[model samples]
Target: MKNLLDILSNPHKRMPLDTLMKCEVVLEKLDFKRSEGLPPSGAQGKEQIFNPLLEVVNKCLQSPLANHTLKRTFGSTLHALNGPEIKNLPPPAKIAKVEEPPMEIPDVLQGEIARLDSRFKVSLDTMQTLGSEGSISLFAELQSARLPCVPPLQVFVPRGYPAAPPAASVARAAHSKPDHFLKLLNKAMDHKCARLPKNCSVGQLLDAWEMSVRQACAPNATTANYAPVPALGI
Candidate 1:
């Protein structure tokens, strides 16, 4: 067996080509144990032969083509002598990189949109006022005055599409029943009148009521507060 460390140590630092050929000839002779008519021997003689073989192996390891050529020779010929096979070499690795897409304003815009959506329901409270019987009282007063009225007792019920005309349940209610609707309108008017200034006109009262209803429907709707009177006499 070869001394693995000795093979590593003298790894062909700088040997002549002719010396390399002579070393190969010596290695072949050692295999048959017929070096200068020396025959095979007992345990002590076996060790002596092994020492010389290891020296040759170490010398071969020092050759220029030692690493590649010796590994090939060992893998092929040394198998019959139960030598450990050389490990196959692995291929060189290929490295590839991925490029990420650019950052965008739209991504930030979408994040802002989502944030607003989350707050929309709660934020809507600022625009709406609750409905009470005051709304109902106003509906009653408009009817008593014999005014042509679409009594605005609506704005309270949850929104839905009308089965018939006007596309909305509130509009349908105004168109369908005039008298009964007026009764409710009057009551809503009376409630608002009691809270507002005594000199407030019928037109002023109606405006306030409409404003109130609009505020209830779209809590986010934009509108000015109810002013007492317009200088233009309206």
Candidate 2:
């Protein structure tokens, strides 16, 4: 036991394989001797008897220079001494959640956005950016002529504005024939923009869009046969 204590104290010194085996045998004998006269009680009594050895073994187990076989032998003895009571392990660390930063609107377009909001009751839904390109999606309440109910208009402003016209579509629930209304609006906007001079303002394009929506949802409206134009790009 003195030799084992000396060996455990100096963990940097390697023990021979035969000496390690002998130490394991000594631990087995000590466990048996301690348990021989004890009543079939809990591990509290056994822990008291083995506490001194347990501390030495635990310290040796944490040493980087300790022999793997010696560590294993000490670990087994620890289990025998404490039984199931030593199985309590520390809980795993929790990972924190990361949040994305809010999108910032360009200073150049803020005035146009403010004007549209005041006139058409526009509210931004989402704004996203990738590299130099970005898009802004918004809901606008438009009370067009002959329209049954005020439909929430969904407007998509693409990366390039003023040069590239923004596309508009009505919500599906708003119009009885949503697809037809969208088709007419798209065709009318394309025709109107083609006739207008180059580099029109964002407000001009939106006004054209609003006019197209009014024409599409007019009481005597008819679905015009026109080739489809692509929606605004993000």
Candidate 3:
């Protein structure tokens, strides 16, 4: 305490790293004990949490404090720590940060889209990005029999695929059914599908939806289409 006081009291004085570390160990033990003695909940938080911490701090203050810049800081710190907010105990739950897994192209899914383009009229293209995270655009002629209307779909497949579904969307808003498509897409490609008939690739999901969309949007589709409105002469 004297060493800490001496160092902080003098603007030119700085505590050695080792000495600070030693003090930290002692202070941490005192703090932990003080916290343990506090109310499990808010047993009148001020008396339970703040008062105990304040008392420990006061004992340190009783030692002669130099009238330096650090003196005002010390007083403020004690008051702030023991102020009104101290009564309520901090919640026990520790928030854990979930880091997204690095983007990986599964061997089964990798280069699979290329093989797909070779078989069907659909083409897969990569768009320019400002990041290392990559995306793909899939499309085909709407007149094609294999895929009557393969609207261009773009999806970001950064690290944390499968566990974190790809960020997906279509080129044309009028051609997209985002909510339905994304839900089905996630279900199809979810790597964590614990049931049988295993999860598939993003490309496959896109392809399946393309076929579904084409069928649903066929000129003869029983699902009534919204009538086109005439544009006014400009």
Candidate 4:
């Protein structure tokens, strides 16, 4: 134990890596004879013999240079020395947690959503207000019976609504490629919104979008007109 303590508290300002390795080997080989010379008084005997050794070992273990095997060996030796005392120790106390306040949507966006809910007769349960900027996202299903294949539309209302036009897109269908279709739809919606009066409501924008979708999907109508033409061949 004294030798181990000496190794742990080396007089050198900076111990060499090889010297530390030799010290570790000495520690691994040193036999901790707990039962041989210890006093018959259980806790008191162990405490007196092991306390200083325990302190040194703990400090060594805390060092950045202490590797996994050294830690495991020290842990096992300590556990064998005081297994009963450690097991008998009480569990730590629980900490009380404070709850945060719920987020409230802005009055202007809330009123617009309410109006949209009433006008479309659609549920606003799916609508989610995003961040402090007052932007919102929602999924709106097409009510047309003719367009059964078309998926629910994802609409994103920007921070400044009525002034800023909302962007809409459709999810890719298993049977059809909606990517091209969505690009045309959004482009047409933006063009229509740009032509609308400055004070146009979200509902009016959505109405224009629905009309565009119907026109794009019509049997006689072709979305190829909206698709960009290839550059003239050389």
Model 2, position 14, has a per-residue lDDT of 55
Return the TM-score for candidate 3, rounded to 2 decimals: 0.30
Please report, in order, the local distance difference test score of every candidate based on alpha carbons. 0.39, 0.62, 0.47, 0.56
TM-score of 4: 0.43
Give lDDT tens digits, candidate 1, residues 122-209.
1111233333211111121223222343433322112221111110112235246555433343434344444665344333434555
lDDT of 2 by residue, 1-234 (tens): 555766776656555566766877877766544544565557566456555665676666567855885655466555655685646678988888765556565565678877664456677774434332456676777554455344566766665665565665655563366566566766776666565555555566567667777777776766554455544332
lDDT at 17 for candidate 2? 60
Q: Where does candidate 4 stray beyond 4 Å?
A: 1-90, 93-103, 117-134, 146-149, 159-165, 173-176, 179-187, 197-200, 224-234
In the range 2-99, model 3's lDDT, one tens digit per residue, is: 56545444536655666755755655655545665755576555435344444545555565653445455444444655674447776899889977
After superposition on all CA atoms, what RMSD does each candidate show versus the true structure?
18.4, 12.2, 25.2, 16.7
| Ten-residue region with minimum lDDT total, candidate 4 | 225-234
TM-score of each: 0.18, 0.47, 0.30, 0.43
Clash pairs for candidate 3: 45-87, 102-159, 103-159
How far off is residue 162 in model 1, in Å?
21
Return the clash pairs for model 2, or none: none
